[model samples]
Target: MKEKMLSFHDVKHIYHTVRGEVTATENLTFTVEKGEFVALIGPSGCGKSTLLSLAAGLLTPSEGEVSRRGSIGYMLQRDELFPWRTIEKNIRLPLEVQHRLDSESLERARTLAEKYGLGEFLQSYPSQLSGGMRQRAALIRTLAFDPDVLLLDEPFSALDYQTRLLVTQDVAKIIRSEGKTALLVTHDISEAISLASRVVVLTKRPARVAAEHELCFDGENDPLRRRENKQFSEWFELLWKELNA
Candidate 1:
């Protein structure tokens, strides 16, 4: 059996604001197996971001359980890299914060940046690079910590359409090559279909699993190639109906 990297079991979360208590999710259940890419999709205000936080342990479920097998790396909608820090420095930030910074760890971070085409820009600040480059640096930074699973919450949503496409391709390759389990929360049906091995669709507010599908592409995992597949449109149409339904 495949090892389960992360799981949400009958989860319920309530947000207590000055206004009142809000139920974000109810009885949510799902499991991401090792090295699997799972995408969570739902309508607007369906508490998708809340789910990401729950996985990252930023929020505790009011009911049920959120479980993980190992450490997690979270990539936010924005790169969130400090402007004062260079790409290399940003990538090393996590390691430094975790007190895991050392010769070997530092070399690994540099190697990842180089492997991902950021070697030449290691000293460049976030402002010196385009939105796409900064996002890549953010991803490399997340990987530098060597987390067992990745939680990506719309990491490419900040870029232009063209940049979003390119960065999505690169991020998909990086995650697959590194053989890491990942949970991505996205509102885009096409993005979910292209990037994930399995897609979990949720209902509107007070979220619950609406549908779950295991994507099939005949061994093709590249986001760009998956977009080109004949099944791409079919999968899109199916997911689209699911979202609207």
Candidate 2:
């Protein structure tokens, strides 16, 4: 069996606003095994992003446990790259923040950039890159620190349809190639099915695990190819009903 990389055990989170208290999750339990790609999907304001925050250790659960075995990298909805910084500099931000910007780490970042087709654009600022390219750079930045797991919060939502498709494939490929486990929170069903090995559906506010489908596709595991599979539409229909339930 695969070792567990991250797990949420009967977790609950309540936001104590001045207005009152609001519970976002209740009895939420799930696990992302090492090297597994899992996507969490639900209705708007259903606490999907809150789950990512919990996994990333950015927020403490009000009850139960959120356990992680290693470090985490987060990819936000936007590229979130600094306009003034070059691609190289942006990718190096994590290391800089951690005060580990040594020559070896810098070289690792450079190698990742080159491996992902961003070598020529290392000196280029974020504004010079296309949307898809910028997202790729953002992913490389997240991977630069070699985090054991990646938390993606609708990383492709900001792109146009065309760009989103291309970048989704790119990000999926990069994550697989690097053998990194990922937990993605996306509202797009097709996007979730395309990139994840498992699709986890959550209920509305006070989110709980509604259902989970383990995906298996013949031939290539590429996101684009997965979309073309005969099973894709069937899976989509099933998930659609679950999401609406």
lDDT of each candidate versus the true structure? 0.95, 0.94
Candidate 1 C-alpha lDDT tens digits along 22-111 = 999999999999989999999989999999999999999999999999999999999999999988999999999999989999999999
RMSD of each: 0.7, 0.8
lDDT of 2 by residue, 1-245 (tens): 98999999999999998999999999999999998999999999998888999999999999999999989999999999999999999999999998989999999999999999999999999999999999999999999999999999999999999999999989988999999999999999999999999989999999999999888786457999889888899999999999999
Clashing pairs in 2: none
Per-prediction TM-score to the true structure, in the order listed: 0.98, 0.98
lDDT of 1 at 208: 97
Give candidate 1's TM-score.
Answer: 0.98
Pairs that collide, model 1: none
